[model samples]
Target: MSGLAAGWASGAQGRTARSPGIAVTIDDFDLTDTPLMSGEERDAAIRAALARHRVKAAGFVAGKYVGDSLDPAVLARWSDGGHILGNHSFSHRYFGGEDPAGFMADVLKCEPLLSGYAGFRRLFRFPYLAEGKIAAGRDTMRALLKRHGYRNAPVTIDTSDWYVDNRLKARLLADPRQSMEPYRRFYLGHVWERATFYDGLAQSLFGHSIDHTILLHHRLTTGLFLDDMLAMFEERGWRLVDADKALASPLLAREPEGLPAGQSLVWALAKADGRYEGRLRYPGEDGAYEAPRMDALGL
Candidate 1:
């Protein structure tokens, strides 16, 4: 009857014409420089890509990364462009490593810095996506979030852009003149594989497509490759939507039943269902698929 419903039916019927929607949310707004460029330069490149694509992202800022120097200006560039800013913790400490109270304090400490931005929203993505070690710890943090009126940001398409950036940074530092073709190919293929898997999982679990929230980072690799990444998504038929729209998916409201609960919401939900546990990958965020290739390339 409705266009969306009709599209869902077509997808349900195994039509290849339907494509999923997704939004980009970048984490750890650390402006530290990489071997190829200064922090400002990297930020400029990322901004340029966002501008060219006319895309706005939700940038979660770690207060520890912001200071009196050039960091505020970098944040301004994002907020000034109508991008949303969210809390990413003060010290980027893992909740599992620290007590629940300590972790909440770390989250609260970052609020002022996030509130300083005009686009600040009461959305919080965990450091390392580490919510807690057990049920009690997870519940503790959830209660704290409710009291503070913060929405927990859930990533649907999780990626390891940070690890790739680390390896790329190391290689660039070793030899700036080395060709980047191998790195680019590996990055694109790896991301594409993950995206396909997650999108398929969403369809299988929900009987239709849900807006996917992708987890990326503020790093040299993304700054260098995001434009191409977005292009690849476009070519694959994905329609990029705003972060808020993606996060508003009703599917995100369901809390999974177990502990060690820091993962993409999709993965957590699948685990809760227990029907597709075998499909779920452990330590969902890593560069294992690309590690050997990177090693062989001498990166």
Candidate 2:
């Protein structure tokens, strides 16, 4: 077995005794694309939230969105304030079904844009968590990333913030006066639910909580509610830590055997384990847990 696999095997014998902490990573900086909040407004809100929480996060940029809808100044704001920046692919294309060569090229396309940012880290998070449909595509990308000095920014806590944003946006558009209380409750509940679920998975796999890298987006929901989200996490006993430190968890190094290997690395590793078969959730992105609750709340 590879060293990483061997380490994982050894670690699996018992969980490490450590406190829970999380680093937030935001992807696809399309802040200007939203009509709900002006670019400046979104920037101010995000800045305020980070300051209020006294935390820093890593933002991944989609190169194509740079001049189209994403403002370069916005990225500067985050990096300047001690947050990190990384590539989110050039065009947010799914690696699955994509030509590995072209995908590598796309990733390279974003390096120029991100390389100058403060705290710019050599990290890359797969768009849509779709690594590849098969081993060749997945393996080729891994090799390319290694050759290019990039590390996979694997997520541990993956929630459906984007879907909730969509539902919230539709509601806002239909009635400007509609109460957001239900949306807020549903959003917080959904995130807490995912956190609990993934924490359980980590405990089962490693015998203790592993530092988590949370996958959230640069969207309206986050810009408006991130402070509350951070507060909720703290209330739940999860400390907010630096993105670089969180990604350093030994759990992130293990590339378990799996096809289209791009979900939370934790989920992928769990799925790759034969013992976890029939016990894990497939396509871990659905809103089935929150949909019914939101619908019942008349949201």
Candidate 3:
């Protein structure tokens, strides 16, 4: 195991050890009605699912989505349900191509909207998971976050759940009575596959399983099947932990030396190490990668 990996596992023996654990971290709370449900209805369903599983998720909210058109109470629901709210920037700008001052200003702009929530935390997730394309840019942002007492929220198991949701919505719009079984199966299978792949990579790189945070979004797909997803993890011998607890893992705090700095944290670390080239992919997970597989299934 590498020194970085060793550091991640240093205090493991003292904790209540179990199988690899994961926490739910949702991003882009884009509140809009879809073919399947109204925005409010979707929010209720997602909250109910989380309540059913007793999971406290971290919701990363982008400020632009929280407008006068939508009720602010929709966001209060997350806080009421005991989930933490984090900043995902105001404009949801891609930081890799953004001017540093503008990006920093956008992040600061989103902070006020979240401050009122009892569950608010000074955790910031980069929109599109793009930190920056250069070392100086990445470090400048990092320094700003540090000075503001914000921790960069990193994703470990990144999935294309948004893509699956898009297809499912389109199918529903075409035929509301279409059997959802196929969509359910595909979503579950895709998530599990990515989970195992990342878990294996983490074990190989860290020589131990680090607590993971799976990147999901607030969408119809998550609202409908989050309960099933949580059950799947539990049945597979993985512990479902609180988002804050999972995020506290020391490994998440380590910044990789790679120039174009963000992806799944494990992927970025491996890229920095330069030994896992064959097993990694650039832009770790995206809709494009899943398009062909879904097309083959006619989904």
TM-score of each: 0.91, 0.90, 0.92
lDDT of 2 by residue, 147-201 (tens): 9899888999898999898888888888878776777887877777676667667
The model with the greater TM-score, 1 or 3, is 3
Q: Is candidate 2 or 3 superior in TM-score?
A: 3
* lDDT tens readout by residue for model 1, 1-80: 22222333322244345468878899987787777778899889887877877778888888888895346888888889
Candidate whose lDDT is highest: 3
lDDT of each: 0.79, 0.79, 0.85
Number of the top TM-score candidate: 3
Worst 10 residues of 2 by lDDT: 2-11
Error of 3 at 69 (Å): 4.5
Error of 2 at 263 (Å): 0.8
What's the number of clashes in each of the models? 0, 1, 0
Better of 2 and 3 by lDDT: 3
Q: Total clashes, candidate 3?
A: 0
Clashing pairs in 1: none
